[model samples]
Target: MNITKNKFILLFLCLILLLIASFFLALSYGNAQIPLDSIADIVINHLVYGIKSNDENGALYDIIWLLRMPRIILAICVGAGLSVCGVVMQAIVKNPLADPYILGISSGASLGATAAVLLGIGSTLGENFIGISAFMGALGISFLVLFIANLGGPANSVKLLLAGMALSAICSAFSSFIVYFANNMEGIQTITYWLMGSLAGANWPLLSKLVPLILICIFLLWSQAKILNLMLLGDDTAITLGYNLQIYRQSYLLITSLMIGTIVYASGVLGFVGLLIPHLVRMLIGTDHKYLIPVSALIGASFLIVCDLCCRIILPRAELPIGLLISLIGAPTFIYMMIRKTYSFGSK
Candidate 1:
């Protein structure tokens, strides 16, 4: 017991250090290549002394503080949120393949975004039309999935997964229909980039707004770690032990949707962080939600920050899409893990 506990503590500390180091690595390795010392100086002077980096108007300071900071922070928030959600969804559905997007939320958000960009559907909602539409679409799909699952029976994992797959297909079909009929070349280009996911739209206002939501959701999730463990025993076993997963499942789905919507708003349709991070963490820590949730959050945040750094510097003149970059890396890693038979996808 002591040995296992100590390993957990050690790995947790490493995750913290890795996150901090990756933050600086992200800040320093962009196109203009700000030095580590300069990046630290700018951040400390502005944050500790209540000074704005832009006040002195150095381009490097401005770039680091103004441009890179928001993107990096948003990346961390989105990564952590998605990774934690991935863990929760897999637990709820009792399926390793379940991800944050399993319930069609991503497709719903994409459909909303396509409508806003091509048909100008949300034009009256002011400048943030696309984001607002996407949020509503994701939230709506979550509710629809829950509703469908609850139709004829007490919504179990199998029903929920099936409902999600069905809704996801419908949403994707709608998105394609709109894209085909609209014939708006410019909007199609925009949707293409947005679908591939970019942190370019990140800003101070959006990051500040999402900070509390992300932090609160993660805390609530961590608090529920004990019950999540009980859930893995299957419904009958959990019920015999006096834990009803129904209310918990619905509540988790709703709360997680907020985080998902926030990410879809800030970054757009980035995948794999949710699916990949939890599996990696579980391979090391076993199935303890106590260790899994927080570690997954930390690793997820670090992974995205580091990946986004690669996206930015991989090309001299243009940045790679983050979604594509992550998919390229994550797909093979997951395949290798599956092939190794080290971590079965919920199979005992």
Candidate 2:
């Protein structure tokens, strides 16, 4: 017993070290390729002496502290948030394919942001119009999906999945229709990037709110680990064990939708983290939510930070969209997982 416990402790400690290493490594590389020591100096000097280093080297400091830092941090939050949400959503629906974005939330966000950009409906919201509109769209679509799923009778996992797909299709159609009619080249470019996802919007002002929301959601989801585990055992079995998923499912769905919506508003649509990260963690640590939640979150954070770094360096003068890169990687991994019978999505 002690040996197993000790092994998990050691594993987690090592994971923390890995996360720190990844953070520093991400900070060091970008278009300019800043050095590790410079990265450390910028953070340490600013944090300790309460001074902003400005001069010849100040430009590097600004790039790291202002640009790279916030984006990387946003990547971590979105990655961790989406990964944890994926784990719970999969458990809620008892389907391995489930993810935060699999529902209509991300599409809804995209639609809202696209409308704001192209149609100028929410342009009056000020600088954060896109984000504000996206969040509203996400929340509204989530409620719509839930309401639709419950229209005929009690909502089930299958119903939720189906309803999400229906709304997602509807939202996608509207987005396409809007673009098709707009005929503005510059507007099209902005909408394209927003749909593809970018962390370029990261900054302290937004990060301040994003970080706390992610932390709180991760903590809340982690606390529900036991309930999540029960959920995987099927509705009948969960009820027999003194738990009711019907009640808990909506609560979890609502919470996850909020987290995903915030992420989309902050970072745009980042796919596959939710779908890919949890599955990879399950392969490493099995299906136990207690272990799955945190491990998946950490790995997801590392995964996105690395992906964001790749996007920056992969192209010389231009950067790639994060959503595009993730889809490129996620699709292959998903195919491999589905082909392998060993993992079996969930317990038989």
Candidate 3:
């Protein structure tokens, strides 16, 4: 036990180092390449010494600071948030295939975003009305799923999963309906791109709000690691151990909903990260949520940073959507994992 714990501690340290390296590496690559030292200097000067960019270095500074930094930060937050949520959701459902969006949050957010963009449903809100609408939609559908699941009795994994699937299908249909009938081609195009997901819209002001929220959610989930471990042993077993998993499952769903809603609002719907990262971590470190959550968070953060970097450099002039890149990488990788006979959900 001590040896295993030591190994995980070492792994955690290494992952933290990897995340830091990925951050710098991502900062250096873009449309206009900035050298590593220059990137470091600019970051240190701006953050430490409180220096602002001047004429000669202003363009580079803007690229690194104003644009790339926020995008990368958002990528980290979204990736970490989704990965942690994935861990919790899978435990809640006791399903190896479960993901953060298993509760229909992504589809609901997409529906709300589609309505805002195509039909101007939330135009009266503010500059970020679309995001606001998406957040509300995600949260609303999550509660609806809970309510439906709890109709006959306490919600269970099967009931929650079924409710989520039904609501997801409904939301997707509504979003498609809105998109198809909308006369605005521009709005339609915007919706298409937004749904594909991009970090281009990331900004400091947004991150200022989102970063804290994501960190808090991740921390809260980590604090529930013991309960999550109990969740894996089946509800009856948990009940025998004096833990009622019903309330815990509902609470976890709500927490993940908020985390995912914020992610969708900031970067649209970047799928597969949530589903992929947690499993990958579990494969390496077994089913212990104490180690699983933090490791998954770091790996997810680094993975998305690299993916975002690829999006910027993949095309000569134009960038690919981060979501598209993630799917391309994640789908094939996941298939390989599925085919591997050695891999099992809770195996050490």
Candidate 4:
């Protein structure tokens, strides 16, 4: 037992180091390509002595602190948040294939963002009206799914899945209808880019609000590790062990919705991070939630930081949408995992 505990501790330390390395790597590379030593100097100087940049290094300072820093931080938060939510969602439904967006939240968020951009909905809600609208839509659809699932009786995994699918379809149809009739090509283009997801809009103000929320949600979910593990044993088995899982399932779903909604608001819809990271971590460390949650979070954060860096460097002048890149990578990797016969979900 001591050996196992020590192994986990070592693994965590390695992942944390990897995450820190990825963060610095991302900071060093961009369109301008700042040097690592300079990047470290600027960051440390500002953090320690409350110094802004001098006139000599003004451009580099703005590029590092103003643009890349917030974007990279947002990427880490979105990545970690999505991955942790994936862990909880899979446990909630007791399905290996489940992801954070399986419950129609993504579609709902898309619909809301679409309405905000094209139809000028929620224009009165301040500068972040689009994101606010998206959050509202995501949270609303999640509750709607819960309501639909509980129509006949207590909600179960199967019922929740079906309700989510039904609502997802409906939301997609609505979004398409709005897009088709809007007749505004510029708005359509903006919506298209938004749906594909980008970290370009990331700023310190947004990060100030989003980072804390994501970290809190991740911590709360991590604290529920034991309950999450029990969820894998099926509801009846959990009941036999003197724990009712229904309330826990609903609670987890709600928390995951909030986290994912916040992510959508920040980075638009990032696919596959949530779906991919948790499974990848589970394969490495087994299905123990205590180990699974933090490991997956760290790996996911590093994964996105690297991916976001790729997005910046892939094209000479333009950046690729992160959602498209992730999908391209995640789908093929997932297919390969499925074909690998030795790799079973939730197996030690």
Candidate 5:
């Protein structure tokens, strides 16, 4: 046991170092071709002392601090949050294929945001009406999924998945219906961008709210690591071991919904990070949640920072959507995994 624990600690340290390296690499490379030294200087000034400049170097500083930094941070936070939720969801449901979005939360958030934009249903709220609407939608769908899954018997993995899919279909249909009839060109344009998922809109104010929420969720889920390990043994065995997963499952889902709502509100539906990173980490470290959660978070954060850097530099001037980039990369990898029979969505 001690040896296993030591190995996990070593893996965690290695992942953290990798994350820092990726962060530096992400800061250094971009289309404008800023030198690594200049980037380092800006980061040092911001981190070490409060220095504000608007000169050429300052403009670079601003771009790094205001534009690129927030986006990178957003990527990291969203990646970590999604990966953490993915780990928790998989344990709760005892399904390797489970993800944070599997319970229809992302769809719900999307529908809410879409309605707010196209229909202007929540326009009277304020500047953040779209985000608020998204939160409500995600929460609503979570509740619906929980209720539906608990209908016949104990909330099991199969039932939870089915409920989530069904609710997701319903929310998607409603969103499309609103999009179809809405004659607002500007609204449609905004909706399209929101769907594609970009970190271009990252701002400090949003991050201030989002980062703390995500941190709290990560902490809560991390503390449940032991319980998550027991969950893989199935309900009957888990019950004999004296752990009641019912409340834990529901509570984690709700917390995850809150995190997902904020993420969707911040960066639309950035998919695959949650599903892929946790699975990959599990493959490396085994299914022990104690090691899986934090390590996956670090890997997820590093993965997005790199991916975002690619999206910035890969094009001539314009930026590509991160979600599209993830899909392009993830789909083929997923196919390869399926063909190799390494790990799959095979039923229990």
Candidate 6:
């Protein structure tokens, strides 16, 4: 057993190294034709030998640092955050299909961002007011869903999902109402683009807003591995074992809302990541959150990096939105999983 576990750790570490290499490659390759040798030289000079970009006005370094690097890091953060949320939600709700966005959080965030952009409701909050509003929207909806679900019962999985769906409808309608009455063409266009989701706006300034929150979410969820394991055993079992999951579940939902809100605000509603990546990792490593969270984080990050790279390369001088790309890839995989007839949707 120890030998098997050691082998598993070694294999997972190897995958992580490969993911890191892929992240670097993503930073190097883009629309411009920068040579790999120069890419390596530039990296080494900047790191091992503290050198600056050769051309003060050149774009190579800008592309590597401002554009590509930030986008890549955002991809990693969004991917990891979503996957962690998925794992935690699944465990807490005792349903494999439960994902962060399934609880109307994304729609609420969208509504908040839309309100900010269209009505200028929070313009006083500064440039990233949309992001701030979106985060609050997500958190508010999460709390509402939890409250409504737990109204008459212990908030089982079915009730939670029902509450989420109902709240999603309400939020979507409000968003549509805002868009319908808003007379700004440019605002409508911006909202449309944001709904599709892109890494085009990635920059250090924007990244700084989210990186700390993402790191803290990662650490907090990682520390809850054992609790997550217990959570999967159902609430009654957890209660019998003297572990009341009500507060834990609510706290986790808040954390998930915060993390996913940052991602949606940064890139705008990237989908399929939480739903797909966590399921894939569970298939590989079992339902133990101790192993599940970290592995899911690394794998989801790598998957998003590759997907973003494909988005960059798939077109000629035009880029596809990463969210659409994930949907395209994930929809087919989801269909295949359903058709295979091998695994139940939510089973131990």
Q: Which ten residues in a row have the lowest lDDT in candidate 4?
A: 339-348
- Using all chains and alpha carbons, the TM-scores for the candidates as numbered come to 0.96, 0.95, 0.97, 0.97, 0.93, 0.92
Candidate 6, residue 137: the lDDT equals 84
- Of 2 and 3, which scores higher on TM-score? 3
What are the per-residue Cα lDDT tens digits for candidate 5 across 80-141? Answer: 99889888888877777778888888889889999999888799999878878887898899
RMSD of each: 1.7, 2.0, 1.7, 1.8, 2.4, 2.4
Instruction: TM-score for candidate 5, please give it.
Output: 0.93
lDDT of each structure? Answer: 0.88, 0.86, 0.89, 0.89, 0.83, 0.81
Show the colliding residue pairs in model 5: none
Clashing pairs in 3: none
**Which stretches of candidate 4 lie above 4 Å from their native place?**
1-3, 341-348
In model 2, which range of ten residues has the least summed lDDT? 1-10
Per-residue CA lDDT of candidate 4, range 1-348, in tens? 112667889999999999999998999997888999899889988999888899877888899999999999999999999999999988887788889889899999999999999999999998889888998999999999999998989998888988998999999999999999998999999889989999999999899999999999999999999998888878877888999887888998999999999999888988888888987876677788888899999999999999999999999999999999999999999887767634445322
- For residue 286, give model 5's deviation from the true position in Å: 0.7
| Residue-by-residue lDDT tens digits, candidate 6, 174-256 | 99999999999999898777777887778888778788889899999999988888877777788899998887887887788
Q: Model 3: runs farther than 4 Å from truth?
A: 1-3, 341-343, 346-348
Which run of 10 residues does model 1 get worst, by summed lDDT? 339-348
Candidate 4 has what TM-score? 0.97
Name the better of 4 and 5 by TM-score: 4
Model 2 agreement with the true structure over 1-348: per-residue lDDT tens digits: 112556667778888888888898888877788788888788888999876867857898788888888988998998899999999989878888888877788889989988999999898889889888998999888898889888888777888889999999999999999999997889889878887989999999998998998899899989998888888777888778887687788888999989988998898878888988887877777777888898888899889999999999999989999899999999998889877725545556
Error of 1 at 218 (Å): 0.6
